[model samples]
Target chain A: MTVRDPFAMTALDAVRAFRARERSAVEITRSALDRVARHDRAVGAFLRVDAEGALAAAATLDARLAAGDAMTDRPLAGAVVAVKDVLATRGLRTTCASRMLEHYVPPYDAWTVARLRDAGAVIVGKTNMDEFAMGSSTENSAFHPTRNPWDLTRTPGGSSGGSAAAVAARFAHAALGTDTGGSVRQPAALTGIVGLKPTYGRVSRYGLVAFASSLDVVSPFAQTVADAALLYESIAGPDAHDATSVDRPVERADLSRGASVLKGLRVGVPREYFGDGLDADVSAGLRRALDQMAAAGAELVELSMPHTSHAVATYYVLAPAEASSNLARFDGVRYGLRADGRDLRSLYGATRDRGFGPEVKRRILLGTFALSAGYFDAFYGRAQKVRTLIARDFTEAFAKVDVLATPTSPTVAFKLGERTADPLAMYLADVCTLPASLVGVPALSLPVGLGASGLPVGLQLIAPAFEEARLLTVAHGVEELLGRLSLPSLD
Target chain B: MAIDVTPARVRATADLARLDLRDDEVGPFAGQLQKILDHIAALEALDVSAVAPTSHVLDLACPLREDAPAPGVLRDEAMAQAPRSEQGAFVVPQFVDE
Candidate 1:
């Protein structure tokens, strides 16, 4: 293979190289580790680097490949994959970027992690994230904030920022990220990469650490649309372990149509998404992408989602409410950090107080308050009902358009600590991406172009639930139109 | 009614969630919570009486599996993770004084 930088190759490309005998799996793993060793110091992307573990896995795969084993034919064989710490990896510390589980080692692999191994992913240790997947910026990580690879000073938009940064920095060909709200897509937008958040029930949540059980979906990050499609196909489908996982035939993306994927497609441009607070650069990028799709024979239909304003409020109340319930397991007894106390109640209180970070505590309290007896009807109940309205808005919109075109985040990557002081301000940054998560529809973010600030901006495509193949096909056509974006060179 | 999120209310909520908030944390927590609650207070203007609560986006019936005994997490493995384990049970603080 003439490719000098094998670490920068996409997952599909790396697999092809392995088959062609152009590169060995061990060599690819070494290259990935080398890059991570060099750049992750500055980016703070990974919480733990399993250099010995990765090499051992790679060596095993290399032996299997050399032995002409049929197992080597699976999609992601030998491709280095960085997993978000939210998912359990047997023997690897999966912290979820929270001090509560800083040294927690899962005895079994999460369903998705095991599937990735079955499909031949070389597990490169756990990545950093916002503590308990609760922040818009990775700064909420009790360990350290992961910087955007695009610019050292800016955030790689979180709570999956570490996985996003790892892929963008060429530490791995593909990485897994979990989306609850805009965690996956927003970070993908900030760092010039493709992120796909499948429908809530499409991927199993068996081993995933629950943030908002109703909203969380394990997603994938890759450099291009095709790689994302490949990664998603491997991870999609139902698992009996996760009761919510739907039993449906997984449809692979039809990229053979190439640029024709856009022809005769109805692309919805929601006016509510293009409203105020959108940065000029992001607006320009969206406009350029829309105009190009139109020129490629796609019909741009203007529409309105009136419930958009209530989405953030609905999400904050609902997600935190679920989080408070989900996170109740971290009491001092069964697993993770513990603080001794004179009494049982004090033991629970002291353990939780010292273990959780500020954002997590705030959410728990907010959730507790919302679900409390007196306020339940006012806050939690009202939010759930409004959630129905938001979902109905999407159901109605889908009747008019095949896919919705919008900004992934209203703005590009912001500076570290920019919104740390104001939690509400930080919450507002996720406005554009939250609605898709709220409704549990499939959405993907593809880089539209770099903004005036010289950072990448993304165009989000929202498809109906379980319509990932259509979403990927449309995104592939858009990628062809935008050509290739030059990723950040951390030289 | 101006619903002020007072420190007393903050401590009560924290208590419900089993988080012991220090005195220094209560003021800042109250203010932040108030701002967030106020922002979400915008949801109050809507008449959602006709709407139903959505617990999950997908319409799904509770999946039932055949009730058969299956292997569960091994006791050794489960016990390996507990903070304080005595014999075969997780040891908690003394629930009642002798």
Candidate 2:
């Protein structure tokens, strides 16, 4: 165990060190905390750090280990995991990066948070994100936009930008992020980390502040596929608290048990995704990735998901519609910030107006209009119907291939204020990622290579629902072929 | 055809969403909503009447748990974060004006 900078070790390596008794839990936790202190000022990844709690948890784990407890029961034993602020952590302030809940602390742990605790993992902090997880860039966060570690001027790509940046900057072993219309994968792509958005029902959503209920999914961001899979294993399964969680038993992913090669695997290339707006360098990088997979014996089949074009329009409708209903709970009367007015209705309006950011307000109004009695069928109804077709497109493609391959985003991380002015242009950032979210499939983003702009380009591999194991394994195979990327210099 | 989102319609939708908007916001919101609606109008071109609407892609029913009582966040604790509350209940502005 010749580890000098413990922060640089991959999460899996850190786990191995812990099991070997080479590194004490406190040492690892302290290293992670130290790194956050050093880099988080520039990164802005964390909204709140639970330093004392993390140390206490580490001390307890060390005590258990000293008592000759093998600690084999906890797969993620001693790993430091940062959670996105949207999850409700018992007695810990969970702001969801919105002023509405800036001072609100939940009375109970979210299902995934409890699972992480049970797995002997240390909760490092709550990360920053788009307020209410409504925007594509972290710029919409009420506090401040998290800068990309790769380039100080660029955004990390959000609303999971903070989590992605934390992992990329090595602020923690790994972090949990939620993906509603590509929040996790897109940021992972931009930050040059591995992000996995499991099938919708794969991970329990209990205690996760609902964004777009049906589309929202809890995901993990890590330096490697195996590390992400480890975090995935700890938090995924059936939870009685979350009715949407699948009833199936949890199966820990076995990355090594699967075939080492991508031989004979059918990989689909969606022709519609290769259309206009994809950067030339990103396209070239994706082609090179496809070629690499072919060399590894994976067969590439070009297919058309004609409804891919409709995904953005469909998602904007369905997601905001759900968000409107979900956000209605945040009125002045209940928990969260309140503004008193002459009447209840005026109070509701005043509180929301004061609480929500512009992007959240925009989406709420869009959703209210979509679900309005006069326009429901034309907007929300049509979008849902189109959503079905989008899912059907995936079903048809999966029938012909094992997984679909595409570039995670059209371009690398754009400048911080580049698309802030144009909501439509900002929405276009999710153009490639929304289709899979609409279809309810498992998707993984791996760093393929850097692009012409000298920023990272990510290759997205998507599998059918509940086929997370297959998705991760294939992603692992790809990651192995591509090798690890160099860490971004803090300069 | 692009649906027109006039300032009146925007004001009405804002009211429906329970959002308080300023005079300056109404014009911009209407204009922005119109642009998005114009983009979303592409969905209208496709004939999806034959397709069933999927609110959620998963085909699973809302599985009901056993009718068992479990310890929930205590009243005092839950009320601790409430902006305004009465005795063991959330306090709101006057709903009925006598």
Candidate 3:
């Protein structure tokens, strides 16, 4: 029950303890970097380490504390946070874990990154991700695949695997990731941590490299719900920089007083998520958590999201369609890698062929074909309508329940290299997490317990769009009932 | 009806994407793309004529900015990123038709 290692402390507690002078920012930042240094060669959580920048920030916080600055406005003062490679971090290389942007340092910070600095969070380093946030596992990273810290043989589900691994491995207090589909939650579920995908446009995407434009969401990874809320608060808000950024005011549940109790809470258990393809460990774990919630005065209502089976198919079409258009800007005329050719068209082809990885190429082609002449209505257009039907399913389900609950991933972290050979198999990894993304609802995966393989199982809670506060509050109630999840050793 | 995923089709799509896919990539990409296409065929059975396509989930119109000059990346910074830069511009391969 006692945590002596300051690195193991959650971001919220660490910030408070550091502010109270119980620990120094420099020490916590140092502990964070030190842990990454020790285990990252095995985990590959961070693509690049910004030790010098992080240390300088930590030193500044130390000086302010020494000068007796209360740092009243900066709630995250002295906290170590990891930025995903996909975000544009000024002066630091924002690779997106693709060769195309391997050395492309952005001229400006992502709005979320700027806000993190404004709130006094040290930018630890850029975490690894699937190239263009396109894959379910970190294997698609043009860089090395990130290993699951829980079990090295397995993957830490991705495209945000590196972010999730960093938090689970105690390398960072919390890490920012983009969830185009299940990048944040799936990885968090597999790695044994907490991840929240804010409602679409909940957080600004000013400097986040575009993936699937409509589906992409900037999200967070933390070891605890309180820490997730704190991180979400630091970054979530309106930004004029991004036109899609919603102007809605942020409303976070007060996690201070153990506020959200399970009493009278109506949780909908989708029957579709519990059917075939549901792994035994995930099924057992979810059932156990629901029973605990029911015992603690929460009501579980069985509901059917009829269009659930079509989520993966619909997302693949719509996401790639958007990605094809969004990624068209990567021609040789811009930043990132370029390969010369005899003419304009040849140059573009050469550069793209040399720069992009396989998954990115596949998605671009799939998207292109979907939106191409004659096939548009059959593929891209049809997917969009099915997307509407899927969203309507949630709208109807929510009328009878507070939040929809399900498993984050169908199973625990599968063996690395297991599904890398099959694109169809990899697409199914996000099946449970895709419906929320397609509908633009706020959803999160809370660490429940270790499954049969001694790996983590996450219970997903999804709320209506712009209902992040309710989502987090209900998740907090579940977290309270489940208690702090004990993590696996790196050994 | 499932569209035939042929090597010719893969090449055609790649050309549209300006991908310049390698010769070896054609067959594999075709097979993989076909598998995905088959899976997505599940959507074809449902009649969605009554449903409106949702391009963006929120249904918010694009917030237009005034048509005025706004500050962006400096010329020097922008030029620095180009692989082939000339007198303050990007240099592209000449495409004078034969």
Q: Please, what is the whole-model Cα lDDT of each candidate in the order they appear?
A: 0.92, 0.90, 0.90
Single out the weakest 10-residue window by summed lDDT for candidate 2 chain A: A252-261
Q: Rank the candidates by TM-score, best first.
A: 1, 2, 3
All candidates: DockQ: 0.86, 0.84, 0.81
lDDT of 1 by residue, A1-491 (tens): 56888976889889888877788889999999888888899999999999999889888888987898755457888689999999999988889898899889898889889888888889887888999999988999999999999999999999999999999998998899999998999999999999999999999999999999999999999999999988898889888898999999999998888778898999999999998899999999999989989999999999999999889999999999999999999998999999999989999999999999999999999999899998898999899999999999999999999999999999999999899999999998899999999999999999999989999999999999999999999999999988978888898
Error of 1 at A37 (Å): 0.9
For residues A1-491, what per-residue lDDT tens digits would candidate 2 score against the true structure?
Answer: 67877777888888888888889889999988988998899889999999999999999998999999998988787689999999999989999899999999899999999999999999999999999888877999999899999998999999999999999898888999999999999999999999999999989999999999898999999999999999898889999888889977656566773335588999999999999899887899999999988988899999999899899999999999999999999897778999889988999999999999888989999999999997899999899899989988998999999999999999998999999988999997799999999888999999998888889999999999888888888888888887888878574
DockQ metric, candidate 2: 0.84
Model 3 Cα lDDT, one tens digit per residue, B69-89: 878889888778777788898
DockQ of 1: 0.86
Q: Docking quality tier of candidate 2?
A: high
Please give the clash total of every predicted structure, in order: 0, 0, 0
DockQ (0 to 1) for model 3: 0.81
User: Largest DockQ belongs to which candidate?
Assistant: 1
TM-score of each: 0.99, 0.98, 0.98
Evaluation by DockQ, superior candidate among 1 and 2 = 1
- Selected candidate, larger lDDT, 1 vs 2: 1
- In the range B25-76, model 2's lDDT, one tens digit per residue, is 8888888888898999999999987999998878898688779899987889
